[model samples]
Target: MFTGIIEEKGEVVAIERTGGGALLSVRGPLVTSDARHGDSIAVNGVCLTVVTAERDVFTVDVIRESLDRSSLGTLTEGSAVNLERSVRADQRLGGHIVQGHVDGTATLLSREPGESWDDVRFSLPRPLARYVAEKGSIAIDGISLTVTTVDDESFGVSLIPTTLKLTTLGDRQVGDVVNIEVDVIAKYVERLVARQ
Candidate 1:
């Protein structure tokens, strides 16, 4: 599990494509400092296990399913990605509970810049629409953010200066794809309600 709190911004150093999946190498000095084989790390909202950790880089295997479901396939060698290690039992949950299990991918639709922040809108997948609510929480590319607005077709979030300065969202443009994880609690509530 993770808190969706980004520890650092890392760069995709290599992606070696294979028949069934791909081997991805990332340079994340902070996250890799104490990482080890089998440790879970959230990379762009996807919880991937470290196959090897050394120096300032770590490698993880991305199965075909993950590539097809998330924006990870869109990454290039130099693409910047949000990185966070799994939450510890003793630390505060700075963000919402995030499994790093990306539900789907969303396209960035627009961005309205504020004096000190940015209000960004992204296209919402229809099937997941019911799970999103205004003022609710959602994880975009692993960075937990509050939903400021929502409709059947899209949703919006306000990004503060710190977010824009520290994460990949700052470089996102209209048409860019990002991973989305709706509030897990909402999904559970819907499931229980349906059985009534």
Candidate 2:
């Protein structure tokens, strides 16, 4: 599990494409500092297991399912990504609970930059739209954000100066694709209500 708080921004240094999968090597000193083989790390909101950890760079095998589901397939060498270690039980939940399981991809529609923050809009996937609500927690590229506005087609979030400076969202451009993970609680509530 993760708290949607980004620990650092990492860069993809290498991508070796296997037959059907790919091995991704990311340079993140902080995240890879104590990372071990089999440890889970959130890379751009997708949870991937550590296959190799040597020095500040680690490798993770990207399966076809994960590649197709999220924006991982679009990643290439030199891509910047949000990185976070799994939340420790003893640590505070600074952000909302994030599973690192991306539901779908969203397109950056537009952004209205404020004096100190940016009001960014993103196209919401049709199936995932129902799970998003105004003021609810959402993870965009692994960074937790509250939905400031929501509609059937798109949603918006206010990115403060800190968010703009810390995570990859700060450098996002219009028309760029990002991984989206709606609140897990909403999905569970919907499932339980459906069974009733």
Per-residue accuracy of model 2 over 115-183 as CA lDDT, tens digit each: 999999999989999999999999999999999999999999999999999999999999999999999
lDDT for model 2, please: 0.96
Candidate 1: the clashing residue pairs are none
Q: Write the per-residue lDDT of candidate 1 for residues 5-33, one digit (tens) a residue.
A: 89999999999998878999999999999
Q: Count the backbone clashes (under 3 Å) in each candidate.
A: 0, 0
Q: How many backbone clashes does candidate 2 have?
A: 0
lDDT of 1: 0.96
